[model samples]
Target: MTSFPDPVVLRRGSADPQAPLVVLLHGRGADEASIIGLVDHLPTGPSYVAVRAPIAEGGGYAWFANRGIGRPVAASLAETMAWFETWLDGEYAGRRSVVLVGFSGGAAFAGGLLLAHPGRYAGAAVLHGTLPFDAGVPVTPGRLAGVPVFVAQGDADTVIPRELLDATWAYLTTDAGSLTTTWRDAGGHGVSSGALAALGKWVGER
Candidate 1:
């Protein structure tokens, strides 16, 4: 129930508010500016927005307090997600086509948002992060039935726990029944050019 300050956002591409909104979420300990560069590699026509997380961590920010890497504290995640949803509703009251693209911790937050309100988003892309698996969201089977989802994971990712990543994969591909798109490789935790290109293609197709 913490009150978060107004969001800080960096926008690129279209200036039209009616344009499709593509939200880019940074990883833990990274600011909006760190992920804003992704706009250059993503699809055009839509507005690409990168918003800074409310909670400060390291020298940057984090979406929620974590019990461990890729493990969000349920209360903290709930509080921050509520704060973010307020901002999102205010900024985009009637707007549609809101797609979430989140990296690392931000990806978990995005997954929380999508899972908590599956009907609210057009699609979500979880890049290099696990979902907020136990953070109070309903991850029951068919939770994301027919929703568009793009998931990119490195088979050798070391930053997020292996079990969490595997569980996320299992949920997205099978249990959730999402129109899931996946790109898995032997890379590590960071995004590669190939992954970015694949993301662009998926976003364009969506």
Candidate 2:
């Protein structure tokens, strides 16, 4: 088993033990604190936790090593996913719903986790990120059948490769068989106000 440093976790929202859990994943070269603001923008009733990725890179941290931006290395992703699941299972030791919201590189990690363990998460939000394609895990058609997924992408996002983003959009909306909701605008690589509002609404309903 690969050993990793302790996860740095930032928490917000309801502290109720029975509340649902939302995991926030940050972009590459960013820390957990970078995405903590999302908790305030999201709905109530769910406790939100932002977990720092285990791998250090670019003065921040990353979920896994990648072949290129938005493309993860298969072995690296598998290792980090295993480490995250171990920590999550130990900490969130209940049947409470757990949702994943990831942005950029973190978005790919979020997609990897859901595709690897479809039944484990309540839902997933892919924000400005791509699905980890060939870096392991199954992206086979209908892998997320009946699952709820919220996706938002910038029409002009250049940070992540265009091909990967298109592929992610295509897979999630069609072949993945997820009950997907998508938002696209002329914005660039960052989150937009519209996307945040829609996410809050979606989280509230789900």
Lowest summed lDDT across 10 adjacent residues in model 2 is found at: 89-98
lDDT of 2: 0.93
lDDT of 2 by residue, 1-206 (tens): 56899899999988887888999999999999999999888987889999999998999999999988888999999999999999998988994799999999889999999999999999999999999999889999999999999999998898999999999999998999999999999999999999999999988877
List lDDT for all candidates, in order.
0.93, 0.93
lDDT tens readout by residue for model 1, 118-174: 999999999999999878999999999999999999988999999999999999999
Model 1 residue runs over 4 Å out of place are none
Off by over 4 Å in 2: none
Task: Judge candidate 1 at residue 23 and give its lDDT.
Answer: 92
In candidate 2, clashing pairs total 0
